[model samples]
Structures are given as structure tokens and as C-alpha cells.
Target: MASLSVPINPLPPPVNRRPDVKPEISLTAKERDEEKRRQKVNRKIASQKATSMKLRSEATKAVIGDKSGPSNSKEPLPLLENLRAHIAALRWESALNVFDQLHEQLWYRPDSDIYIKLIVVLGKCKQPEKAHSLFQAMISEGCGVNRESYTALLSAYSRNGLFDKAFSLLEEMKNSLDCKPDVHTYSILIKSCVQVSAFDKVDSLLSVMASQGIKPNTVTYSTLIDAYGKTRKFAKMEATLGEMLREGQCEHDVWTMNSTLRAFGSSGQIETMEKYYDKFQCAGIQPTIETFNILLDSYGKAGSYEKLCAVMEYMQKYYFSWTLVTYNIVLEAFGRAGNLKQMELLFRSMRSDRIKPNCVTLCSLVRAYGKARKAEKILGVLHFIENANVMLDIVFFNCLVDAYGKVGCFVEMKGVLEMMERKGCKPDGITYRTMIKAYKKGGMNSHAKELKGSFASVQKSSPGLERQNLQHSVSRFDSNPAS
Candidate 1:
């Protein structure tokens, strides 16, 4: 028994058990290199995708019609696309650089499509002179100009108030290109003539269009009506409408009817406007936003706020949303009528509807506040103007200063002047005149004298100003210190 126990004890010396350990993993050199390569490839793919997206965005901005780059350049289409995009995006200098990169054959090669697109882009960028030059270059290159091209050029000139050039181009189209005036051409010319009050020229153009067998479309009638309305020639507008009706050519188009209604509304002929509305319905025509706007503006101008509200209600019922111009019209009417409460309510309604108040709206509010003698409210309006970044023209600033000065807030007036100066706006004659009047009223004789002297100095520096009248004003100020 003792021997057996001794043997068993000797057999079991030590049997130590420990927790299992995981083996460390390590990549081979080749594996590590391959992994790095994969990462680089992924990065390159991402970079390429980003670049493609950028190019697409740029190309969209350029409004490129075709995918093919200029035929001569072997470079990537993206490069040319980017250039065109820059031009469309209004990066004129960058666009020029792109054009420089294009093949010489593409440069100044009159692509009517390209020319028309560029003309529209440049006009939007307010580079009308450059746009005109491009048009001339197109013609010089013997590129056949299309009606669309001529129309774009004419529109650019008209928009920039270059009516002389616009008319010259029209004549060139008729004489050199033998391009008969289309309905759109006549409409553009008629609208331009209306704007410049060239009624006789508008009539002559219409006559020419008729001779060319170009029927006076609805737009033609609308243009003539707008022109007559602008000149307050109600009789002419009515007579024109009558002629259209008698000729059996009176299609009761919304635009045509609106134009007539607008003319009547603008002239404050409420009865005539109503008559047109009845006639429009009788002719089975639906009134558009323009029609409602015309009626609203007319009612507003005539100080018939009740009628204005009724029209606004009609607009809502008809699902016609109000535009900024609509609000502006109503606000201006209320301001003129000295209805401050109504103005405030309208402003609140506009804000509630998320309609951004423009400079005109703020100006109208300020005017209403001034009429009500609510100095605090006027200051609030000024604050809104500044906060909203609505540009305050000289007239607006002058009005504010006058309003504040009238309320004996000389400090506020000076503050506004300082703000204008800080914004890089120089005080004009109107500004100085307003300041002088304020100082004189405030009995700050020395300040008024200083302002008068400064005005005189400016006039002296710029001899074109009529300084004699200002000198007389200064003498009056000197003689009457209390004034």
C-alpha cells in the first residue's frame, strides 16, 4: 500500500494550466504594399468623382447646348465646358481666358447658337456694350443671324436704354438682312416705343408689320395698350380696342384684356376698368394675375382701400398668390392715403406669409410713419432697411433725414449721414440741402452756415452746379439766424 501511494505521488509532479493566448497577426511586405495601393486607388476614384461633379455644375451654369467642345481643340471637353460655364456664371474674365484657350478657328467663328446664348448671358450681366460687339463680330464673320439672335440683341439694347442702337439694328435687319419683322420683333419695338413715349414710332412700326403680312398678335395689341396707358391717352387705348373688336380679330386673350384694363386703371378710370372686366367675362375669358394687379393698383391709387381689399379677396379666392409688387402697390396707396394702421397690418401680413419686404415696401412704411408723426415707428422702419440690406438710394436717405429732422431728431439725421458716408456714398446736393434745412429749423445757425459753406465749396469745385441759388439761400440764412 505504501509503495503504490509513493508511485502515484511521484507521477503527478506538476500539471500547470494557463489561459490560451491568441497569435499576433502581421501582414507580409507584399500584402502591406497591396493594401496601400488599394487605398490610393480608392482616393483617386473619389477625386475623379469630385472633379466630374464640379465640371457638371460648371457646365450647367454655362447653359451649354452641345457636349462637343470646339472642334479644333484636342483638349478635354471639360476645359471648354468650364470656360463656357464661367461665362454663363458671369465670370466674364474667366470666360475670356477659356475663349483664349479655344482653337483660333472657334474664336470669332459665328456660331449663331453660341452668339445668341452669349448675348443673353452678357445682357444679364449688364455688359450690353460687349454683347453688341459680339453681335457685330457675328455679322462680320458672315454668320447668318437668326430671328432669335436679332431679337436677343434688340432686347439687350432696349433693356439698357440704348433705344437708338436698338432701332438702328431693326433697320439693319429690314434693309441688310431682309429679315421681315416677326410678331415678336414688332412687340419688342412697340414695348420700347411705349417706354420712351414714342407713340408715333410705335404706330409706324405697327403699320409696317401689317404691310409685311405679319398679323398684329395679342402681344402687339397689349404693347399698344400699355403705351397708350403710360401716356394717359385713354381715348387712343379705347379706340384701338374698338378697332380690334370691329375687325373681328379681337380674341379675348388675357394679356390683351389686361393691357386695356391696366390702361384704364392707371388713368384712374374705375368705371372703364369695370366695363372691361364685364366685357372680359362676357367674352368667356378668365382674368389673370396681371388683370387683378391692374385693378388693385388702380383702386389703391384712387384711395379706394375697400375696393382694393375686395380685389385682394378675389385674388385669394382665385388662388392667385400675391407678389411683392402687389404688396408694394397696396402699401404705397396706404402711405399716400396716410393710413398708417393699414400699412402696418399689410406689412405684418406680408411678413407672416414669408414675403420679404423690399426697399420700396420699407420706404412706404417710413412714409406712412412720417405722416402719422410716429417717430419711433419711422426709426424702426429705418432699422429694418439697414438690417435687411435693402439699398437706400439718395432719395430714400434724403427722405429719412427730412423725416427725422422734422421731428427735431438732429442727432439721428447726422447718424444717417455718417452711415451713408461710411458705406462709401457721398452726400449729394439733396443731402446737403436737407441738412441745411434741418439745421436752420433747429436754430443751429452756425451749423447751417457751415453746411451752406460746404455746399458752396463743392459747387465751386464742380462749376457745372448752379451755385448762385445756394448762395442766395446762405445769405438768407445769415440774415435770419432764427430761421
Candidate 2:
């Protein structure tokens, strides 16, 4: 009886608490309008950034470098690395096929890490739905779900401009303590907002982060600086830079420096760019090839050809191997400066240097030759293109069409179109638009009108080529700021 008289250990009081969830805020009409204004300006800048970075990435691969090829030291599985390489190359189809092959291998086992990796790859390819499906596969495989997996899916949504879906997922994450959005998650979401030109939402996001006591890290500040700098909000950009410097743990890195330089450099503020470039260098951020490329572009555009040549010489003196982007930039600089002889010489030097020419290289050459009205030179380029075994792209063909059309060589121009078809390169809107202009210039009004009729579909394909039709043929390089 005494043993049964043990003190009753009462159970602790029931633990009960409501989860912390952020209120879903909506933007007012005024805020929306403000974003629209910023959107227009930011999109112009963002599009240029996107185009430049895309070609630059391609250029890096051309030069045996890779900006996005797994920088981590922990080597992944061999098949997984192949998948990553395909992803880095933007070979989405190949990546998917490789992944499929991996799944079928005898050694293959259900792995959440592999699922997340593939999901991230598809996200960058702008295939959010496909990534979403992969997420489902992860769940079905009994691999379980966590914040990282959800964040990867969120990234996919955000990357594809699926803001509503991303936010909804963010809400779901908020409801789940195991998968709440952390600083890295918010940084990605913020960058996504900036990409979509949702500048208005940025302040709200930062406010939420502050409320959450989540101090922004280097990546967060850099993203904001880049977004603001791209929108010409130098005060905001500099303010962000100041904040980053003020943070004891955070400092200016190559990314922040590069973004700031691009904002100033692309906007033709070479002086400001140089000022910041030197400042960043003093801060101990060594320049990369991208740095040299930006220098070349700024100097070239500012008519500081001497400085441009100096940068090239410095690269050579430092034994910096020139990338395809570097060659393209130099070639374009010479072309734009009307140094046709220099352009021609550089092209020959590139060939002799055994640097493989891509569509961009040929496009630059075609443009320079076209500007000089040397149709014969374009013919030589076409011959070189053939020997180089470069796949003919629509841009190359369109440039060819414009080159001949510029010289009133309608026969050759039409023949270029035929060559394009034979090479399985379909003519884009620019192709037809260039032809329409040439036809009008030749006083063939009916022919121009007929081609204009076909433009309905082409315009559907390229909604941004809204420029007015003119006698001057639209070369592919026309929109390339670097060119």
C-alpha cells in the first residue's frame, strides 16, 4: 500500500500556441502604378542584363569556363555531374534525358538530394511546372519534404514569374514550422520580385524581413543594390552599399561590384563606373574577365579607344586568355568606332588564334560589313562560317539577309532566306521586317504589303520588336548594346 502511494506526477500543462504567420498584403492602385513606372525602366535594364549575361555565360563555356557549373568542392555523383553540366549549358532536354537515364541505373536509389538538384535545374530552365511535378515525385518517393525542397520549388515558381504560386507556397511554408521561409528563402523571393520589376513589393518584403528580425546578409543587400542600380536609383544603390559596408560581417564582393559597375557602365556613366571599379579594387575585390569586358565596353562606348586598347594590352600582359565575349566585345568596339580595318584585323587574328567563331562573332562581322556596304565581305564571312562549321542560327541568317538587302542585292537577299530554310533556321519577325523594309526601299509596295501580312504571326512570336519599319534593314546586332 505504501509503494502504491507514489506521488502522482501530473502531466505538464498542455503546450498550445498559434503559429506566426505573415499577413498577405495587397498593393494599392497607386503603388501598382508606381511599380509600373519602375517596371518599364527596370525591364529595359533587366532585359539588357539578361541578354548580356546569357551571351556571357555562353562565352564562358566557349572559353572553357563556366559561371554556373557547380562551384562546390564536394563532388556529386558522376551521372549527377553530367546532369549539372547539361543544366549549366542550358541543355534542358539533355538534362532531363540524363536524369531519366540516371533513374534507370541499377545503382539508382530514391534520393531527395538528387530530386532537389534536378528541380533546381528545371527551375533555371524556366520550367516551373516541370519542377513542381518533380516535387510531387519527391513526395511520392517517401523521401519527405523540408524547407530546402520547398525553397527549391519556390524558386522555380519565382523564376518563371509565377508570383502568385510562389507567395501561396510561402504562406504554406509559414504554416509549417519545419519549413518556414528563412533569410535565404526571402533573398531569392526578393530577387525574383526585382526580376519581375515588382519594385513596389521590395520595400514591403524588407519590412517583413525586419519584423521577422532576419538581418539581410551579403546576398540580400547585393540583390537590392543591383535592382536599384539597374533602375537608376543610385541613391538607393549607394545607400545599400553603405549598409553592406556598415555590416561587420558583410562586405562588398565581386557580385555587388559587378552589378554596380554594370548599372553605371551600361547607362553610359563610365566615369562613375570607373570610380566605383577603382573603389571596389581598393576594397580588395580583384577583377575577373567580366570586369575587363565591362571596361572594354565602357571605354569603347565613350570613344576612349586608347583606354580600350590599354585594357586589352593589360589583359594580354597579364596572360588573361581572351573569351569569346572578349573577342566579340573588341570586334564590336572596332565596328562601332568605324575602325573597319581594326575589326577586320581582329577577326583574322581571332581565326588565327583558333578561337571558334559562333553566331555572335559572325553577326558582328556581318554588321560591320553591312555598315560598310561591303556585300562581298559578307560573302567571305559566309564562306568562313561554312568552314568553321558553326550552326546557322536565325540571327546569322537574318543578318545575312540584311547585309545583302542593304546593298540593294535583292537576289542575294532572297537567296539567304532560302539558305536559312535549308539549314532548318526559321526566319523570325526580324527576318520578315528586314525584307519588308528592303522591298519598300526598292519601291515594291505590294511585295512589302504581302510580307507585312505575314508579320501577324511573327509579331506574336516577338512582341517587343515594335520599332517602325524603315528602309534601313534590321540587323540582328541592332538590339545588341555591346555591338
Question: Which RMSD values do the candidates have, in order?
Answer: 14.9, 29.1
Q: Estimate each model's TM-score.
A: 0.67, 0.71
Please, what are the lDDT tens digits per residue for candidate 1 over residues 1-483? 455345543533346546568898899999999999999999999999999999999888455333334544444466658867886687866775665555353323446776777777777677889888988887987888878888889877876778888888888778755564588887877886788787788778878887888777667776777668657788888887777766676464787777777767766789888998898789888877767777878888777889988988888887898788788888888888987778888889888888998656776776677667788998788667767777665556766777787777788888887888877655667678888998998899898999899888887787654454445434432321100
**Measured by TM-score, how close is model 1 to the native structure?**
0.67
Can you tell me which runs of candidate 2 are displaced by over 4 Å?
1-111, 125-144, 442-483
Best by TM-score: 2
The C-alpha lDDT values of all candidates are: 0.75, 0.82
Q: How many clashing pairs in candidate 2? A: 0
Candidate 2 collision pairs: none
Lowest lDDT 10-residue stretch of candidate 2: 65-74
Candidate 2 C-alpha lDDT tens digits along 1-483: 455555588655457545668998899999999989998998899999999999998886544323223343222366677887887787877888987876665545688887887788889988999999999988998998999999999999998899999989988998997998899999999999998789877888888889988889989998998889778898989888888988998877888888888878878898889999988989899998888887888788778899999999999999988888888989988987778999988888888888898888888888888888888888888887777789876777777888788887888887887797789766666788899999999998997898788788667766654443222225444433432
